[model samples]
Target: MRYLKYFILVLPIVIALEAQAQEEDCAFKLREAQQLYDAGRIETIPEMLQACLERGFTQEDRLAAFKLIILCQIYADDLEKAHAGMLSFLKRYPEYELTTTDPVEFRFIFEKYRTRPILDIGAFAGVSLTHGLISQPFTPFNLNNAKPKYTSDGFGFQAGALFNFYASSNIQISLEPMYAQSNFQLVYEQEPIEGIATLDHHEKQSYLYIPLSGTYEFIIGKFRPYARLGFQLGLLFANNTSSSGIFEGPDEDNLENRNQLNYWVFGGGGFKYKLNKSYIFVDLRYNVGLNQYLVSPDKRFTQPNHNWVYMYQDSDFRLNSFMISVGYARSFFNPKRVN
Candidate 1:
């Protein structure tokens, strides 16, 4: 009789522990799916999560698992699977509402699948025209009071995605996250004492950039003219500097003249030609740098003024660029007009 009573007391505890362990297992599986998705393993997620979605122990786990599967399918370019998954999700959770925490891309796709709007997701690539401006102390070593000089023009290219959010008939917000290859040339000229008179330096840099702009449109027949005002941020990734003449030393890599980060305020006007739901655009913009491009060193050079070029130098230099780009994009979501 005493053993029977003990058995009765332990049975409920064992059952509860088993249930808890099952719940934990389900949570772990869902987390694993999320990890794979976040790690850019889009193609692997569907297979890895099939079992979890089929056997989800709770409503939250099933919902999360389904969403992951649908997202993975969309990224993998399997639109048919994505559409089917989304339909199934809606059928399962008819009252579920999307939150702000969800990925904007996913929300955009879902809205397109439901109620369409004038939304665009586009990719663009174009050439760039950059003019570098360097400002120093006007001959810090009192060489001649000559201002810093730059190349006439350096050429590069930029590529990125353009997401256009149309608010109304005459207004839209265009956000572009891009990668740019910017190259520049700097020249330091001195008295022609020898063959090595001018120090010509060329720098090639890579940056990740994003430009957010508010645009206004004026329709004229088939062409739409628009103007935009915005700011851009550029994060430098890699820099390579090469020199010739007097500036050429054993160390060709000079970290002293490079800036790791840069930003600019920009404005421009452009025109677009409409063709059904797709359009081609050409934009011309000017960018002005807001900060110094070089860092000042702590140590000073006590050597002769001629050797001053090798020492740490400070300058008030800024970047400016005139860019002309042309690309095409399509409107994927166009909402119905209410009359």
Candidate 2:
């Protein structure tokens, strides 16, 4: 009884001491990784961070550790892991960036995701250029032009992500959701008018795009060839920034009545290749809009006194793009901070 009492009393103290020791070790490791990164010695930071991760730190520690890992991955020129990492993180923590106080730091992480090993991500800063073949019909042009139902060029920007379950290195089942914005002018004229009424306009669409695709990848050394079949779900985000009404010209009117979102079905395919620690990616996809720009009851989908959103729901915006996104990624664990 006496021995048991003494053992019990000492065990808590011993355990507490051991825990403190482990925490100090993790703190030391994290500091070391940050220092090395600050010093621009990136390659070794991962190793050190991984050591700390393996030591089983708290959740906050793990989060910080992953951030370091991501930076190391970017510096090391590993894109495959970067893309996969972005997808994984966003899916798990979609609004993690929104919750942070330091948006600039968060942006650094995003810029890291957008940058390529061969090309700077900053080059594609505002616009991400892309090209993909249409395996499915993604064209949203009106055989007849109305308010929002019309055609432009075949290329713009597919600025969202496509999801896929990789069955294997060469095969994956895909569910890709993307978003894009396009600014263009619109012309509207009633087919049978008493005299002649014409309207010239400009508008933009923010689409909530979703595509269901099956991707078949062919691996030849570092080269990858893939195919896809899917459609897009477009949601309207905004309308004409500046426009003219039916009675005036571009400089003479404000046409807020002609904004809408549209949906469509389209498909395509493309190829990608890998580099030492990065990748080069490209694709060509087509968009086919299924609905009209505005229904019959509302010409231009306009209201007597306000914007179109309050009058009626907007259809999917008729906008598609040929997209190219490049990414790099790597895995790391580091206990020393290097610059």
Candidate 3:
């Protein structure tokens, strides 16, 4: 009985000693990490902190390391990475704090409401601009306008459904089919026909772009952001009846008059939300032209120069995009258990 009582008494002392040893070791490692940091040997700090974590440090230890990591990231001028790290740390140790310093208030502002769902589905309709070869002014067979201008900005209309299949809590696959139109007009802008800029006669061209893309998303609950890589196969649907007239020149100075279905790279990101099992979501994307529209050389009717350069100005390649459509999301996933 006496030995049994002694064993219990010694066991607690042993446990207390082991815990004290572990804390001392953790403090030692943190000091080492800070020394390395002061000496600008920063790459070794995470490794050191990770080692301490492997040894089961106190919550305070972990929190202090995280806060220091934030300061380090700030000094490194990597705001995006720093913000992401701060957010992630708060997720794992929501209440961790240090004895010497008060926790930053901003660190936990929206934490409780930040975590969100993994899958989403929805449909949306918005305006788009076909920054493609087909001009818009000559569209609808501009039997009216006789001139086109660079300022002949066009409009696009689109409607489609999108689905997000989250591969992981943090990664997702996106699939969507959207019907869209690119319409624009070619006209003379500043250099007027008689030294005056007017909405002169314009020719419009119209086409449809059906893009198939795969996207990788980086998720932080309701804030599901992503990057996409996809190809758009465009189809020529309408053009100016004036194509055979003023536009039908050699495929040189005027490719807009002779544009065909083309392809481009599509990529962009947006925020997401959930409404129920059947959620609606929104995202913004941009089409970057990969093919040259106008084959004209800057030699102005001269032969191709020795330098095989792309005619960007001749192609008039600019970003074509959609707006708030990027973040307007409505997901309807029956959250199994959000709390």
Candidate 4:
């Protein structure tokens, strides 16, 4: 039993030492292959590096090996193998950018292939500020005698995923599906039979939204700045309201008098910082509501309990929102010829 315990502890160290030895052997072989290439032994270079390229080379070592092998095939007048080698190099390192130190022949071969991302899918979470655009005011009491004010009183949160399909190097079409929550407050003073009373009402709503957009991106160094224009469709899934001051009660579900479908048009711009094969991005957007959020006028007061017990009537308003979000995305690429 003691020997078994010791074996378990020693097993990992043994495997790690073996891996280190293999890596060192591969590194020595790679250096030898480079020297052979420099000495004009181009024909033997492929066989010299084949074993390490298949197994023990690290990521950086692998890139250097592929570059060296492709150059050797080019020098040997093996154009078919050279082209195939370039294709495999691109597939392995899709985000690689050519440097000035690269040979002119390498640049020529790289230019013959397209290595842009085919699609990028990611998720994001953020906060939003919502403003109500009131077209008409509603009150259980006489509007002539009382004044009501509506304000965005709280921050809302949202989370969603984006599906970005690239049409070209700088153009893409995107679909974003999100679940969002928002809040607003209403305050008013009314003259009751005995005295004046002040009331405050807070409403919270949750929705499912899908926005389809077209994006134009500017590739500037590692920062990609982009602008998007889109229209969104939203379905209200939950609505709850609570009141304070003179008329106060437990929170009540208020989805009955609210419109379920919301239409919006939004535009925004942001930048992304490339990190390896993934990107970290920040986005800002403003959504303009196309229609009122309340039900039709005749149906607004259909719930007698809402008016008599709660003494609350929803105002006819459109919701506009400004949102900021940060997210990460991984790009998938298909390397091929432009033709």
Best model number under TM-score: 4
Q: Model 2, range 24-66, lDDT digits (tens) per residue?
A: 8888888888888889988877677676565556667867777
What is the TM-score (0 to 1) of candidate 2? Answer: 0.41
Best of the two (1, 3) by TM-score: 1
Off by over 4 Å in 4: 1-18, 138-149, 188-195, 244-246, 301-312
Give the candidate number with the greatest lDDT.
4
Residue by residue across 27-66, what tens digits does model 4's lDDT show?
Answer: 9988998999899998988888888887888988989999
Task: Give a tens-digit lDDT track for model 1, residues 189-277.
Answer: 64333453655556677789888888898967569899999999888777666554544554344444456678899999899897656
Go through the candidates in order and give each one's C-alpha lDDT. 0.69, 0.50, 0.52, 0.86
Per-model TM-score versus the true fold: 0.57, 0.41, 0.42, 0.86
Task: Report how far off residue 43 is in candidate 3 (Å).
Answer: 54
> In model 1, which runs have C-alpha deviations exceeding 4 angstroms?
1-117, 134-145, 188-196, 247-257, 296-314, 336-339
For model 3, residues 1-339, the per-residue Cα lDDT tens digits are 999999998999999999889889888888887787778877657656766664657876876776666656656767665666667665665323334353353343223223334556666777776543434222222224333333325566777666666654456666666666545544432322333322222234455556676667664544456667677776655544222222232222233334466667777766555333333445677776665443333422232311112111222333244433532344332222122
Count of backbone clashes, every candidate in sequence: 1, 66, 38, 0
How many clashes show up in model 4? 0
